[model samples]
Every structure is written in C-alpha cells, then in structure tokens.
Target: MSQQTGSLISCTFVCLLLAFFAGQSLPVEGANILGVFTSHSPSHLIIHMSAMKALAEAGHNVTVVCTSVPKVTHKSIKQIVIPLTEEEEKQLNAGMTGMAKEKPSIINTFKNLLGSLSMYIDKQVDVLEDKRFTDLYKNKDNKFDAVVFGFFFNYYQVGLGSLFNCPLILSWTSAPMSIVDESVGNPELIALVPSMNVAVKPGQAMNFKQRLANYFGTTLFRFIGFYLETKNVVFYDRLWGKIPDMISYDEAKKNVSLALCNSHAISEGPVRPNVPAVIEIGGIQIKEKPDPLPQDMQEFLDNAKNGAILLSLGSNLKSENVKPESVEKIFETLSKLKQRVIWKWDDLKHTPGKSANILYKSWLPQDDILAHPNIKLFITHAGKGGVAESLYHAKPMLALPVFADQPNNADKLVQSGYGIRVDLLTLEADEFKASIKELLQNPIYTKNVQAFSKLYRDRPMSARESVVYWVNYVLRHHGAAHMQSPLVHMNFIAASNLDVYAFLAFVLFIASLISFVVLRFCYRKCCGGKGKPQKSSQKSKVKKH
Candidate 1:
C-alpha cells in the first residue's frame, strides 16, 4: 500500500476510537426525571418545560410526572399525567374560575384535606408496594441517577422521592428560597440580594409591625399547607391502604441534595447563607425564542412617538372581571396620556371606547413587547414571571398586584426603584393618571431598570446551563449528599433559640433578685443614718425620763 493511503486509514481508525470513548465518558444515555408541577398554573408548567428541554438537549432521559400536560412540545421527554377526580376537578375549576358560589366553601379545602389523607394512607399501608409506582426503583433494569420534584403545594412529590430512594432536587419557581433554603431560619426577612439597596436602604428597614405582618403571612400559608397535606395522607390511608412514613419535611430537606430556584441574582437579590448546592437559574423563558407580536401592533409601536405602555394582568385574571368602574378609570387615564398604550385585555368588549393612541389585544408577546424600543412602561400584576421578564427587558413597571405573592413582589420592585405599586382595589382615575405620568417622566426608574437588566443578562452562564450543570452534578456525585443541611429535624423554636426560654427565665429571675437586694442596701446606706440615729437617742432620753 502507498504511504498516503495507509496514513488516511490510521487517522479514520483513531477518530472512531475517540468517538467511542467520548460516548462512554458521558453520564448516561437516559435520565428519568420526575417533575411535579402546579397542576393549575401555566407558569409552573412553563418553567418545568424549560428545564426538561435543557435536560433533553443534554441527552438525559426526562419523564415529567405533573398534574397536567404542559404547553411545551418535546419528543424526548415522557409525561405521566395524574388526573384529578370529578369532585377534585370541580373544586380546582372553581378555584381557577373564581366562582365560589358554584361550590360549597369546604369543597376546595376538603380536596386538599383528602389528598393529604390519601397520601398518608398510601404510606401506611404500603399501597405503593406494587410495581406501578415503585417499579422505577425495583426494575433495577433502569436505574435513575437523580429525581427532580417541583416545590408546589403538593407534598406527594417528596413522598415519591422517598419511594425512589434516589438523590432528590427541588425546583422552586418562586422568588423566596425559604421553602427549600431553610438555613436562613426566616425566608421572608432574608433578602435574596442583600447588596442592592435601590429604594429602601438596608439600614432604614421595615419596622417590627411590618416585619410581623410579613412573617404571619408566610407562616399562615405554611401552617395551612401542612394541615392540608397531613389530612390528605390520612384520607389516602383510609381509602386505599396504610402508606409508609413517607411524607416528612425533615426527610425532604435532608434527602434533597440541591435546590434549583427559578431566579437570577440581579432580579432576586442574594439568598441568605449562600451554599454551593443552591443554584439560581432564572430567566429560563428568556432563553427561548419569544413569541412575536402581530404586525399591526408592531407598526403601532413603531409609529408611536412618545413611546408606549404595555398593560397585562397575566393569565389568571380575566380582564372582564375587573370592575367596570376600574376599567373606566383605566381608560380615562390612558386616553388622556400622551404616551400610547398597548393593553392585554383578553376581552376588550368591556373596555372603554377606544382612543386614537390606545390599543387592546387578547394577548401580547410580553417579552418582545417589553423589548421594543418604543415601549416605555409595563403595567403588570407583578407575577414573578412577568417581573423577571421585565427585568430582562429593562422596562419600568406600574404594578397593580391582585393576590398571592404579587403584593410582596410589587413592594420589592418599588423598593428597587424600577416600579410603582398602584392599589388595584381602590384605584382612582386621577391618581392613576398622575402615577403613570410620574413613572413615565422619571428618568431614574428607567436608568435603574436598565442597569439591573445588564446584570441579569451578563451572567457567567445562562440559567438553562446552570440548571443542567447542577442536575448532572447531583447524578455524578450520587445524589450530592454533602449539600444537605444538618439541622433538618429542628423545629422553629429550637432552631431560633426560643427553646432556651427556661434558661432565659432563670437568668432573668436571678438578675431581678440581685437588683432588689442592691437597691435595699443602697437605700439603707443613703437614708438610714439620717433618720435612725436621732430615733435611737430620742428613745433613750424618753426611757430615762
């Protein structure tokens, strides 16, 4: 053979060998991911889909076990849909529709109660003993390297994690890390980013009363959550069989190897007690190709000379339900404004008669709309998803928070100097107009938002990449046991030193007694001689007489 031909064959042989080794070095061919997401909320679905996409791209087998089918289309992932019963579905639909009259008040609450009971029963009876659920564990045919569970209201995911006996990671789509990062003791008080002092300087902090209110708000939610979950476990046991001792906060916290929060450092400040295992992989949606706006809306934005304001209440709130009076006020305010308005009013029939500059649509491409050069302000409900997107786009906001964590989110936004919080319940046309004008005219809000936007976008790695890295890290480290917190079993009082009340009381009592004795001694030393000597001499004189 010629020398050149022999060399070519050798090079090809080397290439094939390298490719085979590279394939072997990869973690595994398939990663079976079990994702539990909020059944009702699209936001959770969106986040789960994003993470699933990233995992799929990384060549991991992904199986999502969520309450409902998500919006995203992915061929690589398998979805396990758990359907709600007719009664449960009714309650869920009622909650979503805001139609309390259609069902008894106890229905929704009872559903949660029942769910907790059911889970408890399942655990006690070992009802999940069968291969249907535990099949993932026993099959030994297909071992899962890691399990990812959503941190929604349901605790069943944690139970499922226990069943699998694998490394578990929590994917929190909310702003506060308290649910997963319990080290800080108090989730609400611990600001995610302690460094950014935009509106309220750190020193000029919220007073005790305000802090108490925040604490109560979070604590109340947690208490109700626990009660509902426990009830579900009990109910499940009665219906099926006794479930094992599978559901526990301590177990979940201890077993969870890593936390993946859908938050960025720029938008969500530094989480307390920063640990290597807790990863903030926010702005996942921004990583995707944003849905585009209609051409007419684009043309309108292009033609607007004074810039535009984008108004949206997210997906849950039906624009139709907004009181007509509030709508009138909004229209009255918007019509007079010099700036053009692009409002996402799903049902526009109820909107006030149109103005030359005002536009209404069933939906708007929020990210694209925010990114538009002509868009100046975002009127949002302060959903975390919307707030994160707004931060990414660098658009200041007029936040009209309705419910849930939105009010708190708005407070953060206003405090951060990038938004204004307008009370939705008692909105006034004139006040609304004035606030909108102020936000538009104020250059600082724009400047601050733009600054944060830069920080949000200039991360070391994209949110998707960060999530993928940690998911793999958990698998590679055999569930990353080193990352778990040691104080998993401690309660609030024990963890906070409130459990030392007895010692405190003893010290206080001793201090009080010592103070009383000192005071008596001092009284005698200062005033006794002046009155006593004369009394002794007078008594002696009287007796001699």
Candidate 2:
C-alpha cells in the first residue's frame, strides 16, 4: 500500500510540474491595435490594409477604420468601412482628373489642388465623427495599444492617437517626402535629395534646370502643406470641441512614432538620410510566390506565338476618360504588333477596337500577369505601386504617365535604363509603336531591369517580414520614443540652434567693441596727448623767437 501511495505522489508531482512549465511556455496575448485610414484611394488603402493584416496575423487584434474596408482573412482583424458619398466620389475623381490636366508647371498643379484640400479635410472629419470611431472612443473598456494613420494629406486625423492615448504610426505608398519627413523632424536635404515629386537619381548631380525644378516642387509642396495644416486646426476644433483632454494640432503630429514608407533604394533612387523612426517596407504587396494565373489568363499567355505585353493605367484612372483618338492611336499601334496584348480596361464597350492579339479585361491580376515568363513588356501609367512591382519582377516598361506621381515615376524609370516614357496626352501611333518595338528588340532595357530586380528582392528580410517585425518591435518596446528625433520636440529657434549662435555672436560683438574702445583710449593717451605737449613746446619756441 505504501509503495502504491508513493508512486501516486510521484505521478501527481510530475503532473503539477508539467502543467506549470506548459503554462509558462504558452505565448502571451498581443496588444490591441487600431488603424485609421480615411483616404478613399484604393492604392493608399492597400498599404494600410497590408499593415493591418500583418498585425492581425502577428496575434494582435487590429481594428481598421477606413473610408473603405479591405478584404482581410485574419480572424483578429475588425474592419469598419466609412463609405464616401456620391458627391465626394465625384470630387475625388475630379481632383485626380484636374491635376492630370494641370499645366506642366509644378506650382500650377499645387494651386489647382488647394481648393480640393479643404474638401478632403472635411470628409476626413466626417470619418472621425462616424459612429464606429465614436463608439470606440466612448467605450471605456475598449483600449488600443497603438494607432496607425495613413499618411496621405490627412495629417489632421493624427489626433486620433491622442484621443485614444496610444502611439501613432504613419504609413505611406512612397518614400518620405519633405513634408512627411518634416513632420517626423527628418532633414529635407533639398539641394542633394531630389524632391519626392522629381526623378533625379542619387549619384547624378542636378543640372541647373533640375535644381530649379526640385526647388519649385519642394516649395509648392510646403505651401500646400501649410495651408492644409492651417485648415486642419479649424476642423480639429470642431471635432474635439467638447473633449476635456484636447491635444493641439501641432502636438499631435509630434507624437507620431514611426513612418513606414513604401520605398527601397534599389528601385527608387536618390537614397538620402533617414531617422530611425522611418522604416522602408517597399513592395509589401508582392507575394513570396505569384498566385496561379486564372485558367483563361494561363491559356492566353501559353498560346501567344510571340511574347505578350501588359498595359495597365493603374487603379485611379478610367479608360473611358482617355480621349477616343488617343485610345484609337494606342490600339492602332498595338494592333500592328505581332505580340499579344493585355490591357486593363474598365469599360468593355469603350475599348480601342478589337484585335486578334489583344485581350481586354475590366481588371487584371497585375502582379501575377507580370510574373509570367512570357510577358516581354509592361506599358503602365507609372503609378508607384506598379513601378515597385515591375521592378521586383524585372520586366521592361513603356511608361504612359497620366498624373500625380506618375510623371516622376516615369522619369526615374527612363533614367534607370529600364524603359521609355511617352506622354499619354500626346501619344502618336508611330511613337507608341516605336517605343514598344524598342523595348522588345533591345536587350539593354531587359538586362537593366532584371539586374535591378535581383537587388530589390535581395533584402535581409522580405517587405512583409519587415512589417511584421517592426509592428511587434513597437509593441514590445511600448512605442519607439527613443527613436523620436529631438527636433520634433524643439521649437524652430532651438532646433536650428539659432538662439545659441546668436548669443555667441552677441558676446563676441561686445568683446570686440570693448577692445576697440580700450585701444582708442590708449592711443589718445600715448600719441595724441604727446602731440598736445609738442604743440605747447612749439608755442614756447614761438615766444622765444
């Protein structure tokens, strides 16, 4: 009996010990995260959505409040879609269209967008007041550990971070521009680094015209930024009117902890300095392996006697909006080519005539299509996301930039030796045909892009991996407050050290003045006083005579 009892005791002790270790081994629950993206642009939403999905997959409960909720499979992600009104949609379309048609001058583009900026801000205010955001705000038990804001022009909505008492993160679709960099207290380096809107390469020195363009672009961007910030203060006042713990517009921006930019040095050149808070997760949308192309797409590519070409104008523009003649010219050129063509056309009825070699689709799986071994060239609108993807795939491009960053992207692609640019507005069949023929016939474009693709993909960690690592890194450290630049906390005078320099200058000036007075006094006593005595001596001599 005693032996049995001893055995039982030993077994029980072993069980208890196992249970203790097992409990310790289990992972801790992740912190809750909130992501606010008010912009209705699909491209911007993709970057933010990718981040939210990464956080959710990392065992965090993520709540995304956006104008349109993206499709996410993670169980931890909660999406709240704040839909845009019909008129707001029209305004958004108009803004893009108008900017595309703006005069070639950078200043004129900024001037045109100024009126639309206020309307965008007002729409964002509606997002903050939405029942979904209000419910989260009012719910005493609902707390978030961090908040991520889409860093479009909507700097005002960063106040959500303060309202929720959490760390704020800004996600962008491109590298940090001067305005975005300034918000995080990063150096602008206006003379060296090309403006985000310009395509000057890193190694190349800017010519007089390029320098002029960079300066004008940087100035115009800042002018618009100031106007938006000024407008934001008013909208924020109405948004935060009743809250007892109100944070000012300026204070809210300073609290931003990290900026996740969609840029990599290999593809997007002109690499410049960055603070620790700025993280580049370029090509985050790319998958480790391309998804299997649809059956029809697979068959289409397989059946092509010659290599295929993919033409996409990106998500924002409609094919119907392109002038009919321009469409006809593009088709006229493409139809002559023996290679198969796949174009992203929204309207089936408004296509650029039918051709045996051309396939028209309302939407194409762009990344997958580009990945196919048979695709020889990509004719694109030069959107940044598309540009990044094409670089990753190493496909030669023929850029037909429509508007916004497209012009800049197209210019850089040409500079990089990867492609040629044809103004979509002035595309002639002859020029379009020649550009397409050149990319296909020459091996240099293909060689340059393929070399770049290797570099772009040869990162220590993949873009998605970087995103997941940083999201958890921030959560582990409880906000990267150590990474925040001192400049963010400093006033203009203090940040520039102008006050200290002025004090030194004043002290030096005072010392110099005192030295001059002392020297003059000594000179007068030693030289001038003796001269007066000499004059007395001369007068005595005169008396004697």
Candidate 3:
C-alpha cells in the first residue's frame, strides 16, 4: 500500500509540473494565418511571399491559396494550387494575348467578358467553396487569427476572410490611391488645387484644373472598380445563398478590418487628405539579398565594363506583340547607345549584329541586376515591381509604359523628376536614343531617384512589421471596428456626390426670393411718388405695357 501511494504521488507531481509548463508555453504558440493571393501577377506574388515569410518568422502558421496559372514557388508557406480548367485557361490566355494585338475580335471581347465572369464565379467561388476551405471552418478544431487578402485587381478574396470569420486585412499592390484607401480616410489630392498639390520639385506647382482633373480621374476609376465589384456580389448572391459579398466596398468596409497599402507617401508624393487606417507599407518585398543572377546573366554583367542598361517590358506585355516598327526602332536605338544593354526579350532571338554589346535573356533576376554597380539605366514598361525595385535600388529609369497602372507609375516617375517617359507607340529610334543619352548624362534624375529611395527605405519600421502589427491589432481588438470608415457604409451618391447640386438649388431658390422681395420694395418706392401711395391705374398701365 505504501509503495503504491508513493508512486501515485510521484506521478501527480510530474503531471502538475508538465501542466504548468504547458500553460506557460501556450502564450507563445504559433498563430494560424490564411493568406489568399489570387492574382497571377509577379508583383502580387512577391509581396504575398514576403509577408508570408515575415509571419512565419514571427511563429505563425501560414497557408497560401493561389492559382498555378503563373506557376510560382513559395517554400515557407504551404501553397495549395488551384488549377484552372483547360477551357478557362484558354479563354484567359486569349484575353491577355488578344488585348495586346491590334483591334480585338468580337470573340476575344466575348472571351474577356466570360473570363471576368468566370473569375468572379468559377475561380473565386470554387476556391472558397472547396472542401479544404470549408473543412477548415467546419472542423471547429482549426482556427485562424487573421486572413490576409493580397490581390492586384480582385476584391473577391475579402469573402474568404469573412467566411473564415477572422480579421480581414487588404494588401494593395499599387500606390495609395483614394479609391482603395478611401475607407481608411486617405483622400487623393485634388489635382486642380495648386496649394493642395504636392509639387514633385520646387517651382513645379500643379494648376488647380490639373489637380481637380487628377482627383476626379482617380475617383472615377475607383467608382468603376467598386461598381464591378458590387455587380459581382449581386451575381454571386443570385447563384450562392446570400454569402457576404466581400467585393462590395460597403460590405468590405464592414467586413474587412484592416487596410495595408503597398506604397510610401514619400515616393507617391504627398496625398492631400490622409487617413489613419491606411498604413503606408511600401517596399514590403525588398529582399535583403535577392536570388543570385543565373550563370549566363552573371557572365553578361561581368563582361560589361561600361555600365549596362536593363530593358524589360515587364511580365504582362510580350515582346513579340510589340509592333515590328517599334521593335526595329528599339533595336536600332540600342545599337547606337554606348552602354551595353541586357534586354529581357522572352520570345526574340538573333541580335542585329555581333557587337556583343547587347545580351538577351528570357528571364532575368531584376533586383539583383539593379543592385549591380555596373547597371546605370533601367528601361522598363513601368510595372509596379519594376517601379518599386528601381526606387529601392535608386536606379533611374526610361519608362515606356504599356497598359493599366504602368502609365500612372510612369507619370509619377517622370513628374517626380526621377525618370523620363516615352510613348511606346510613337517612339522613334533617334528619339529613344536621345532620351536614353539625356537620362544617362543628367545627374539630377539619378540624384532625385536616390533621394526618393532613401525616404522609402527610412521608414519607422519594415512594411512586413507594419502589416503584422495591424493584423495583431485586429486580433487583439476583437475585429478593428474602429478602423473602418463610416463613409464606406453610406450610399455612393451620399458619400462621394457631396450634394453640390442640392446646395446649388437651395442657393438659387433663396436668391430668387430675395430678388423678388427687393424688386417689390424698389417698385413701391419708385411708384409711391415721394411717399404718396400709387394709384391702381398706374399699376394696371404698367402691367398692360
């Protein structure tokens, strides 16, 4: 009996010690994080991967649900490949390729329309309704502290966060514009308001009309995007039982708890109206040491004793689609240039000559090449990744923007005096050569770019940390209800229209009433004949006349 009692006591003591340690260790355990990145764009991929790695470093379990359409590799995060059906893949490819061609066919237009619909319904809805996602929520055993939705164009990912019943944080892979960051209270500047406009440099004040145009332009874009999102939501509601429509701004504002903009105020210049909830976390994906250049690339960079020029039209625009005239111009222009050129011409082969001055590659380690000492000028299509990388590396650029946000990025770069813009369609070989030569010769452009780079990098904290902090804030606050904008919940006209017409009507009515009263008094004074009452006959005569 004594031996049994002693053994029991020992076991009890061991159990108590284990329980105490377990309780203590529970506070620091890993958090479950679900990051939805549906955009096939490389920039979106980079930003999502960077944030995922950061969360992992902070002892969080991250699961990324992305499509294998573009085929990206992320080691730290568990990537679930959402494969596209063959027909859907063909339709999508047709849209992208067709858009680049001269005058899209009716079939291409139809395909694009179908593609958009499928993106909203088939791709997005299918992913959300998958057994893996449903099981995650239904198991009751699994829970996520937060869900990060990173996408360039699609707002539907916000639905996944709502479905998971976790804090929703939006990561925008573009500059902090009013439309996306409006909920967070950041209003884009009135481009027409010269005083409100943040000049790119001294003595370059934007006129009031220009400022107003910029403001309205951005607002219109946002409104269109919001409209499309709402339509998608309504469509989804009809198909799927009233699941929360995350695409709607009003719905997202209510459901989405946090906003993380992938931009810096400094590089984007000054925004007239700033919102507290809209956190600027630019250069979030700037890796300390990016992957090394491939062997062929290293050899080319090594051979270029003179500085090399990097020319890339980005991932979306194929070099083959470039007009033959433009191609000849670019090749001719590059041939005249003194600097060696490394062009990412994915589908092209056979150089104009054996000058060994130009090197061609299908894929290039862009960041690594930018960081190289011998790389002087970056001629690019002004995509977000290239823009961010150029800014991060302090490299000046010759921006030949093709489509979408590339034009905006290029405009900002040129307006900031950090780069020059060349219209791809109208560019001549001599003009292209001249601009490149000018940019290379000018020290101001390089100096300005480096200055911007300093400000972009000198933030209070890393962008990853900012995102993590906000995500934790949402978790700790039991949903960041306070961060949401009341405006997002209001009707579009009420929120943005500002009732200017109503105010004008009210003012006109008051003015007309005041004028009539004044006129009546004046007539009485004139017709009274020095304080004597005017006869009814005089009034009748005036009326008849």
Candidate 4:
C-alpha cells in the first residue's frame, strides 16, 4: 500500500511539471483590439470588417464600433452598432448616385465636400454618444491595447486612442491618396504618383498638362482635407473637452502608429515610396477559395452554355435609382446575348424587363460569382474593392462608372488593357451592347488581365496575413514608433524644404548684390570714374558743338 501511494504521488508531480513546461511553450494571448468604422457605405465597411475578422481569428479580442454591422462575424468580435438616420442614408445615396451623373471639377468637388462634412460629422457624433461607446471610457477597467480607426476624412476620431492612451491604427479603404499620405507625413510626390482622384493610364508618363492636373488635384485634395480637419478640431474640442488627456485632432493624429491602405501597386500601378508606417493590405477581403454560391446561383451558372456576365453597381448604388431609359437599354443589350446575365437589382418588381438569358437577384456574391469558370466578363461600377477583386481574379471588365472614385478606377482599367469604360448616365443600348461584345470577343483583354492577376497575387504574404503581422508588430513593439517617418513631426515649410529654399534664395540675393557692388567699384577704379568715354574725343567734341 505504501509503494502504491508513492507511485501515485510521483506520477502527479510529473504531470504538474509537464503542464508548466507546456504552458511556457504555448503562444502568448493576443492583445485586445478596438475597431471603429463609422462609414455608412457597406463597401467601405467590408474592408474594415475584414481586418477585424482577421484579428479576432488570430486570438485577439476585438470590439467593433460601426454604423452598421457587416456580414462577416467571428466569435471574438463584439459589435457596438450605431445606426444611421433615414435622412443621412438618403443623402449618402443621393450624393453617390448624383455625382456620377454630373461633371466633376475642383470647385464643385470642394462644395460637395463642404456639404458632406457636416452630415458625416453629425452621424459620427451620434456614434460617440452611444452609451456603449461612452462606457468604454467610463469604465476604467475596460483597457484596450490598440485602437484601429477606419479613416474617412474624420480626423477628429483620433481622440479615441488618446482617451485610452493606447496605440492607434488608421486604415484607408481606398488606395493611398495625398490626403491619406499627408496625415502621416508620408511623401506625396505629385510628379510620380498621381492623385487618387485623377486617373492616369498604365505605363503612360505624365505630360506637362497631366502633371499640372496631378499637381492641382493633389493641392486641392490637401486643401480640402485641411479645411475639414480644422472644422473637426472644433468638434473635438466641443465633444471631448471634459476629458483631461484628450488632445487636439491634429496632435492626436500624430499618435497614429501605422496606416493600412487597401491598395496594391501591381494592380494600381505607378508604384511610389511609402513610409515604414504605411502598410498596404490590398485585397484583404478576397478569399483564397470563394464562398460556395447559393443553390439557385450555382444552378444558374451551370445552365450558362455560352458563359455568363456579372453586372453589379456595388452595394451603395440601388439599381432602381437608374433611369428607366438606361435600365431598358441595359436590358435590351443583355437580351440579345446568348450568354446568361446576373444583375443586382434592388427592386425585383421593377427589374429591367426579364429575359431567358438574364437572372435577377437583389444581391449576388460578386467575388464568388466572378471566380466561376463560366463568368467571362464583368460589368462594374469601378469601386476600388470591385476593381481589386476583378484584377485579382484576372477577369476582364466593362466599367459603367457612377461617382466618386469610379471614373478614375475605370480609366485605370482601360489603360491597363483589362477593359473599357462607358458613361452610365448617357448609355445607349447600342453602345452598351458594343462594349460588352468587345470585352467578350477581344481575347487580348483576357490575356492582359490574366497576366496582371499573376503579378497581383505574387506577394510576400497574403493581404490578411500582412494585416495580422503588422497589427501584432505594433502591439509587440508598443506602437512601433521606430518605423514612423521623421516627416510626421515636420511642418509644411520643413517638410517641403521651402524654408531651405528661402534661405538659399536670401544668400544668393545677398551674394549677387555684393558681386554687383564689387564689379561696379572695379569698373570705376579701372576708368578713373569717368562718366563718359574720353577715348572718343572727336565724337565728344561733335556732340558738344
């Protein structure tokens, strides 16, 4: 009995020792993350949610603050929903739909921005006032290791990190523009990297005129960003003035440790230098294996004997908002095709006249549908996300750009030989039909896109993996300040080297004046300070007479 008891005791001690060693070998727990994405656009929300899902899956506790919840969810994520008002939704929809129809200019764009800033501020303020959000600050024990903000010109929200005294991450759903780069003092080389609003063709060098457009476009974008940010400073003061550590929006922005941009140079070319703090996580939302299509969707694709075309104007633009004439034209063009068509229509009751070749659905899995072997062509609105996906799948496109970045995105596609662009506002059935046939019949488009797909997918790591690695890098290094650019701390004069130029100009002017004085003195000494030429005695006498 004594020997049996000794053996039991020895085995228990060995088990305890093994457990301690196993625990030591295991990975450390992930840091708690807070993601704030307040954009009303579902497309923009997807980019933010992708990152959140990735972080959560990597064992981090993520808290999301958004105007609407995304379809992508994970067990580690806790959402704090902030709903938008009816009027706000109407305004956003109107702006997106209307802008595509109107001609874009710097003046009109600035005016639109002024109008939208107030609405965006109002909507975001409502989110801040939500009880759940305030409680994050109210409960001192609710510590966050990092705060990731989905930046959409709302510079004021940087204060959230200040309130928590945590490291901050800023994400841009679109490509890196001057407005975003300037936020972190990243270089905005206008000569090389064109503004996001201006579309430059692939491999097309900018002429004086194109460069001028880029310069003005970049300048105006920066000016508008500054104007809006100044207003947000006031809003920040009014809203968080009571909090002792809350800093000005400008000051708080400097605390941003890193920025994740949804852009890849391979697809969106004219690659430029980025500061260490700016990381590109483009195509993060794209899945290695697209989600399985629904039963009806799969069946529809299987029935497409002549292949299929996917037409989606993106989530924000309701198809019903399309003019009746344009809708009929789209239908007429599709009806003539032997191929099947999948259209994303909001109002199934008023869909463009039904055809045997057309399939009408309120929503389609755009990426999944594009991935199908039968999908030969895509007609899209040129949203950055859509553009990225199409490029990733190597699917050729016919862009019917609506508004915002759509036109620019379309132009790049055309330039890249991946597709063509048609004006959606003034689309004719004949022209629309011609464009589709051109995209399908032209094998060159397919070839170019397929080549690009290889380049886009050739990366050191997947987009999701990049996000995980960088986010963890920030946490591990306590904000990774070592990687931040020195430019962040510089003012405009220092950043642009205007002060150096000014000083050099001053020195040049002073040297020129000294040289001029010395030359004049030398001339006088050489000629005895003569006012007139004494050598010309005959000419002098003739003049006197």
Per-structure clash totals for the candidates: 30, 0, 7, 1
Per-candidate TM-scores read 0.72, 0.90, 0.77, 0.89
lDDT for model 3: 0.69
Candidate 4 segments exceeding 4 Å error:
1-28, 104-110, 116-118, 522-526, 529-545
Measured with C-alpha atoms, the lDDT of residue 83 in candidate 2 is 92
| lDDT value, residue 453 of candidate 2 | 89
Identify the candidate with maximal lDDT: 4
The lDDT for every candidate, in the order shown, is 0.67, 0.81, 0.69, 0.83
Candidate 2's residue-wise lDDT over 1-545, tens digit each?
69999999999999999999987555434778888888777777877787778777768888888887564336678888889989888877777666555433355545655665346556877888888889998999999988988876777777877899987888988888866786778877777778746677546878888788889878878777778878778877878867989688878878888889998865566667788888899988876799898898899998988989999988777776576778899988888889999988988986778898999998788888999989999999888888888888989999988766778788888988989999887778888888998999999999999989888888898887787777666766677788788888888799778999999999999999999999999999888887897899999999999
CA shift of 309, model 2, Å: 1.0
Better of 1 and 3 by TM-score: 3
User: Cα lDDT of model 2 overall?
Assistant: 0.81
Lowest lDDT 10-residue stretch of candidate 1: 190-199
TM-score of 1: 0.72
What shift in Å separates residue 192 of candidate 2 from its native position after superposition? 2.3
- Candidate 3 lDDT for residue 44: 68
Q: What TM-score, to 2 decimals, does candidate 4 have? A: 0.89
Off by over 4 Å in 3: 1-29, 69-74, 85-90, 97-141, 188-205, 238-252, 335-338, 348-355, 492-545
